[model samples]
Each structure stands twice: as C-alpha cells, then as structure tokens.
Target: MCSRIEDVITEKARTALLQVLGPLPWLEKAQGEVRPTDQIQLIRPYKGGHELALARWGFVSAGMGTAALKKYAMFNARGETLSESRAFGPAFRTQRCVVPLSAFYEWPTVDGKKRKTRMSRPDGLPLLVAGLWNRCEGSEGTVESCTLVTRPPTSDLLSVHDRMPALLLSKDLETWLHGTPEEAQTAALTSWRTGVLQMQAV
Candidate 1:
C-alpha cells in the first residue's frame, strides 16, 4: 500500500481540477512528498459544485481525539471490504474523492530483503487514485481526513508490492465519487492498463 506519495500535479491534471473547483483560491500548489496526517488536496462533491478541500491523509474517527491519530493507521482502506469497514465504508459510499498522485512510494521484498521503490505512470500523467474522505469534529478544530483505497496489485506491479492504490481514469473520477456505492465498487475493480505503470527503485 502507499504510505508516501508525491503530488506533483502536472499542467493537465491541474487544468482538470481547476475545471471542477475554479481557481482554488486557498490551494498552495503543493509539490513533492505528502505523508500521513499531512493536508492534501481533494475535490469533494457537494450539492451545487465541487469543493476543493485540504484533507488529512489518515481518517480520524469522530469519537477519537487528536491523540488517537498516532495510534491508529487509517491511511489505506481495503477495496475488497470497503462497505463493511467502519472507518471507510460510509465515506466510500457517499464521500468519495480523487487523489492525484505523481507517484506513490512502496517497499518490495526481493530475495527476503525489502527495498524502497516508486511507481508512476509511464506517460508521466498523474494517477487519479480513488479515495474516501470525511470531516470529524476534533478538540482543536474540524479535521478532514482521507484514505486511499487499495486493491490487489496488477500482475506486473505484484513484483514491486502486493497491493497498489485504486487508480481510475480521468473520465471516471467524478463518477466514482458521486455515483452509487455499487458503481463505486465497480469503478474500484475496473481493469487498469498494467503496461502504463512503471516501477523503479527510489
């Protein structure tokens, strides 16, 4: 699963997001490494339009305080059991979002030794990773957290890791977020072109 990600949104992806959230006044155009608990960009589907939001990388429960964040790892949600999971089910059903990643970091064990690696699109396009986000009232303030949905790795990617982020095409991004839960599940398991995924030692 992806623990670290580089969100260097390319011009094309920036254009796509801008079309949804128009100007993104508060967005700082962050580039490079984004880890758990960090505020990352996400486009939330609202009633009238999309809201560009800054969401924490890990999902924080409403009943839990800030102290519990360090203890629980809710960064990556399993796609196989999304609907049944307490942490990610609700959000997966209604609060889905897209996570644009330039590349994701992974650790693959080869010959019984683990080595850090990075996965990216061979065409240099951004990976529109499927994700779920929610807002919880915290002691400090409202904490909006998001978790990346993960699925069994494609044949080629299994060599690098056992799982990879659920990446959707640019066209299917919004549909996965606003559509029904069944549609979201179908989108999560959609066949992806494995050849475009390039993995290399970081």
Candidate 2:
C-alpha cells in the first residue's frame, strides 16, 4: 500500500552515492528520456562495488502510460506470494532489485478510517527494501517497473499493519542483489530480525 514515496535525495546526491556502490556500465547507456514508463533508474556505485538501482512507485511495465486506470497502483508486493503470483513470480525469481528509501508511508485504519504514518529505521538509516522488476509491453510502449517485497510485520510493526515492506540491511545487500536463484529465494523469505523500525503519525 505504499502508493506515495518522497525521494528527497537529489539526483546529484544519488549519483554520488551510486558511484560508491560499484562499477556502473549502464550509466553510459542511460541516455533515454525518463518518463512514467521508464520507472527504474540505474546508478553506478562509486568505486566499482555492486551497482544500485531504485524502483519508482511500484508502477509495473504494463501499467505505465495507461489512461484507463486512475487508482493508486500496487507498489508493495507481498513476499509470501511473490514467487507464485502471476504478476511478480518471474521478476522475483530473476530481476530482483534494492529500493533505497529515507522512509515509507503506510496508512493505519481505525473505526473504518485511515490515517497516514511514516515508518523508518530508529537510527535513520536508509531502508533498502527488496524489489522485483519486469520489462513488459503495453499498448503505449515498453517499460520497466518494480514492486516492493513485503513480509509479515515484525512485532513492533504489527500494531500498525499486518505486513511491512521487506527492508534489507547494507550487510545483506550483496547476497540479495547478486545471489543465485536459490540463494535469492532464501534471502527473500528471511526477515530482518532486528526490529529497529520507528514510526510516527503524519
């Protein structure tokens, strides 16, 4: 249900950070016009480490450039069914990615109403949520989009929602990003044990 995301970090900062991630061979190829259809932005890691990428709002390739749909799209993919769902199975198995966020917004319902809240790690570290992306063709054109992977909420987050985005730590980034298919599946199912998340009303 993470429909709106605030990417406060500027492009320059993102590029600078990416340079530290790893060698980015694609940066030279990233010349096309960025549109709603072009959802994934690739950044070169600073010193030729692992390249980092970000997904934009979970808008999948098929949904981009469509005029008929008006609803806020599904940005978070449930981890339980990620490998089985038709919409995400293939991407989950192969096109896994890491989504970096300062914080993410979730709505808590009360008495049949909803209120917005922001969730972040207690130490204010960027949350590296696991994601799956796909390149699909639509009537308008081809596009790449991604969905945030989600798991059962930790004890600290259960009061707000039953599920929370799959947040990976810096230590686990490599295995999740470049691990083999089997290793990736194992990583996706394992929850980040440290319930260091903090939330506040927004």
Best by lDDT: 1
What's the TM-score of every candidate structure? 0.89, 0.70
Estimate the Cα RMSD of every predicted model relative to the unseen true structure.
Answer: 2.2, 6.0
lDDT of 2 by residue, 1-202 (tens): 4554433444543564455354343332233222232354433223435554544545464554544333545566777776578777777666777766666777888677887778766654556677776667777565556667788877777778777778775566777767775676566667476558777778
List the candidate 1 regions with Cα displacement exceeding 4 Å. Answer: 16-26
- Return the top candidate by TM-score: 1
Q: Candidate 1: lDDT of 187?
A: 85
Candidate 1 per-residue C-alpha lDDT over 1-202 given as tens digits, one digit per residue, 9 for 90 to 100:
6899988776766776566545554454666778888888777777767677788899887797656777888999998899898877778877888777778998888789888888888777778788888888877887888988898887888787788899887667656877788788778877465778788886
Candidate 2: which stretches are off by over 4 Å? 10-20, 23-56, 59-73, 109-113
Against the hidden true structure, what lDDT does model 1 obtain? 0.80
Error of 1 at 30 (Å): 4.7
